[model samples]
Target chain A: MNTHAPVFESVAKEDVAWLGTDPIPATAYYDPAYFELEREAVFRRGWIQMGHVCELPEPGSFIRRELEVLKASILILRSQDEEIRAFHNVCTHRGTQLVEEAAGKQSRFTCPYHSWTFGDDGSLLSAPDFEQFNVAKEDCGLSKVHVEVVAGLIFVHLGTPESGMRESMGPLADRMDELPIARATTISEYVYEIDANWKLTYDNFQENYHLRFIHPSTAGQGCGGDNPFGYPEEYGFQGPHRTQTIWTNPETGIPSAVQGVSYMKIGEALAKRDLMIPGAEKNYFALFPSFFLFGNPGTHFSHVVYPISANKSRGVIRLYWVGDDENASERYAREYGMAMTRDIHVEDRSVIERGQRGLESGALKHIHLQTNEALLRHFFNEVDGRVQAYKAELEAQGAL
Target chain B: MSVLPEGYEALEPFVATYAVDNAGRRAEMRGEAPSEVRDAFYAAAQPLLAPALDYLDTKQFADYDSGDKQLMWMMLSLAHVAIAVEIQQEDEERHAHLRSFMPVTRAPADF
Candidate 1:
């Protein structure tokens, strides 16, 4: 058996020590109380990626996202000024959600409950019985969420973060900015509402260890054999964020039967061009908590894991194509790439639910981590560190 | 009572043919329907779409007028036909159906 050692040299200095020895406690996956702690410690305070700027290509366009775990209904929109912003979807008057549709475009939004209106910039424009209210209209504008757009991706912080997304991402920004993400357009989206914890759903994407076992037919065939996958070419951490690069096996050739697909040609063309991360065909960059971007040469795909409860989560995978100019070749390529990625996603879904069931059973006390699973260890360490610090702070205040 | 545009009495039976199953799954074509079938359906049903869309745009759908509802049903049925054609095209062009399955059958075993 060939076993490759998982390297932690790229992990943050504080997180490096927990690599091999830490057997992740089962409670981290299935415990309801711990899940609540995670919401407070992690999801609430950090910068969460909402969507990409390209999604709102035209000024005045908007998209609404319902984040059930954070108890947040958010509207991320581009104003008439062409700046993207995020705001609570709730009306300030009676707290009725201002936007009803998942997405639409308008320079102004009027709450359906009352006639309260707000501009795309979130400034209150008007409300019913304005003189009857003592509060200043200026003060009652839709509440703003801290929003920043970096490398074409829009991120919102629900609570105050110590630093902005650009600063927090550090060197990772240069790597992500180099991609044509700003010019890339979204082609499609895949949404999965699963019966598993958000972290469990995310952990499945963080490693390539299960490719041979779990994806034996779909991804395994694409990789070229039973053991076609390999260790991440390069991996590292920037604050709470991290990334890993996986090189495509150059020897693998597409079966002629599948060659008509434009997606099949994308990999071969990308391998010849040095557009992606150095020495890798695909790179997985993760913003700690639940956002991940998997970038290949001609395309990039993202996954947002949103916790619905301790045991339920919603995963959205959005695919983007960098070159918008579409001819016959480009159209075929996009379809092929989307179909291939989708099948692999279906394979992973089965195990993620089953793994959660195993953790809930309480028969297993600790889940073992293999040598190549170093990133999983690094992830747990960061999560544990944050949750513990939050616990400590609450204890100090006598609030826990 | 059902409201009918004067002289458009044939609309009810056509709309009744399009009701979705209780499971909300699209009603399937009984046998393999060709693209020409979809093209013909879309061509014939194209005129009905405008009034239904107009009702949707003007928010008259909320009123649930029987005639408008019948038009909506016809529009939805045409969409199902187009979707089934697209699904077939995806299967033939990419062999997507073949790659996504494991060979198993519920059909009666040959004697």
Candidate 2:
């Protein structure tokens, strides 16, 4: 193993205290070294959202997903016996990517590079020169990752088995269950390749303070009227996850004045229908590292931020709709939901890209954060803690 | 009343077909709703169809590749329109009682 020791350091006195109430140092968004540290300390150890169970509902159904920079491709499969399984997408033979397609159902996976085949259970089914190699077929099965399903949503952890999925998720699974997630169906999925750090995108999603300005049409109209909603200080942290639950009045259906313009309109509408869960209503849950899930009674939308580089990120938003009718009405509902999401996402993307450019100027080292954006502060604190912990582990192991 | 516009007939069947196909997929993900209701929905959307065959034929997905970014944007936009129309139509029907009371009177009683 090429152990070029990872350089880990405490944020300077200025950087450390700023995280409490100010935006993180901009350099953290563009520095290559920071990205590497994040991969090891954060992404590798974090519980990442994979896909919904609906995506692989059947016994043989499977979906291929990747965490870009980690070079980790996962094959989420439902075996013949109906057990959900997740395996590293790499073939055991020559270490080639087994499934090249994004998603499909299959009984077996064949590696194009070496023609090695693996069964749905990830057992090594066939390999050339099997007898010549002393390795047993059972022992040659594809590597497996820890997988967990919480409220029809699938999550994977790259960490050790001892870490445990339930332990990793902590209170998130319990909190998520309070919502009507089981009723949700996939409405639409949008992916964007943004020229900004993954953290920058997370920073944008962490607070609703920007809604009045950036999303004036929607947020301003919906909550900014006489009500003028605000984030509660009752925000709490569950393991690496941070959550803030907000309660909107039942009478006011989403404010039409800000209907099309606000980013929260779709979420607000869904919440009113009782399709989304109460915890997800008007509240935000920032699942540490890379995933954020927004819950409401009618719909649940999640955004997964995959870091491509220090300055580039791939953001995926999946909208889940809850309804029995899959007809014109439902289709129309889904389309409208998607459009609203697109408009808001476009606005966010524009701002983040500009933020990235601003960071490059080096004119400013840090940005300020409002009290309502307490989640962002928690995120930075978690990141800092993880980095420190990883360094400590390396030092104890004599690896640093 | 607006002559249903040009290509509306051809678009109708395409829209209906696409809606039916998508409804099937959605039904599979969610549980089955009333088949008749789903069928009727597709039937309604059939008249508003506009297939992307022509646009897709000319543009190479690989050439414009931004890792499914463009395709996602288009799909999201389409989904938004789909849902918004449903909400709007439902709202209109729920408030139809209010509109029903508007009486039609002669422009001038004296003739």
Candidate 3:
């Protein structure tokens, strides 16, 4: 469904004065119109993370992803030539979804409905009764989508392919190289469905202030208490992406109550063995719009936020380990890690669901933002500015 | 085969079978954990086997290898016991001085 075309209007210099501090309309969370506008202005226009490169380890490996909101299907495949490629997951003959499964290794994708086949490189391989149609083989090939990799993480943008992925990722890509993400192996995956605005889920992750209250069991044991850990002043922001490095007083021995259980044991083990990595402390980075990368000194973890609906979001949290080993000890640890993550996710889901119900109460006109929530405020402000600009541009062209 | 723990009757056969399979696999892989320590972990976790088995039945645990879920849970339980034993061992090495400095209190119930 074509909802609305994004419009960009030039803003007066004076109008930009309240850019970051202005309160956005709450309707942005609940409005169907706004969601449609976002489909074009945000999802179509920006680089959205798809999957990791490791997922396509061998040639002919492919994964199918559904962009339900955009009404689009994507097929990410590793070609026979050993290059990763993404194509519209549709058959040219009758517009049928080519790949039905989530992931597998296949040299060619044959549509179940029409028996049309496509090669690993997304070339139209064959069609039954070719004399009937005037379609060329090249023209009948699956439509291509812009795909690029940053440190083994793959991203695809569906809009105009003019803006390169590197250009869109900007400085964030360089900053990500500081961590050894390429060497990391997936240890566990915790998936959860939360009832809340997608932005609210991001709001919860961007700030650690709610850790003590929302995640009392884990976060309180790990971070909260007498000497609360705070975000570093040297916080870096590139485009909509932001990161905050954490520092703990060495004398304290333990940083926060949240750090008491897991971190205390991990830190003690590292310190005693002199195995600590240099220049590493707790670091959290939020890739604008939807992803979070959190490093716990050694273990690297990521959360991919998928917006399913106005009031529902799916969070896929995956923890990565340092080495690639299928040993019993490592496997055992991975299972426990997954269980712990599942418990933590259940905690977050309950809170976000309650928050959504509260938001519907309309008891408060605006949510307060603390210094710790500056990133959340910044994100909303950025979205608001884009939406306003698009609205104004449409009005000016008499297209609204 | 004296009296088994409360839930051990339902789990003992599975645990015994798993122990044999695990030991065989560990031997094949050149793996070993202290026998005394391993026995202690198995004793403590034998009662919780019922719940762990139930959890496994639901696919609650991460699939690390193609094996029975009970065996996987036992391996994980053993790892936790191993880590705890290692920490206690380290404390002993430090002249038991570390324990006196930071007395172990019961962690918060929620935690």
Tell me model 2's lDDT, rounded to 2 decimals. Answer: 0.60
Model 1 earns a TM-score of: 0.74
Q: Using Cα atoms with residue i matched to residue i, what is each candidate's TM-score against the true structure?
A: 0.74, 0.71, 0.73
| Tens digits of lDDT, candidate 3, A284-328 | 777756888865533456787777777777776766554442333
Complex DockQ, candidate 1: 0.03
Model-by-model DockQ, in order: 0.03, 0.06, 0.06
Misplaced by over 4 Å in model 1 are A1-20, A221-229, A260-280, A323-325, B1-111
For model 2, what is the error of residue A184's alpha carbon versus the real structure, in angstroms, after optimal superposition?
A: 3.1
User: lDDT of all predictions, in order shown?
Assistant: 0.66, 0.60, 0.59
Residue A39 lDDT, candidate 3, scale 0-100: 67
The most accurate candidate by DockQ is 3
Off by over 4 Å in 2: A1-24, A168-171, A223-234, A247-280, A395-400, B1-111
Which candidate, 1 or 2, has the higher TM-score? 1
How well does candidate 2 score on lDDT at residue A397? 94
Answer with 1 or 3, whichever has the higher lDDT: 1
| C-alpha lDDT (0 to 100) for residue A290 of candidate 1 | 86
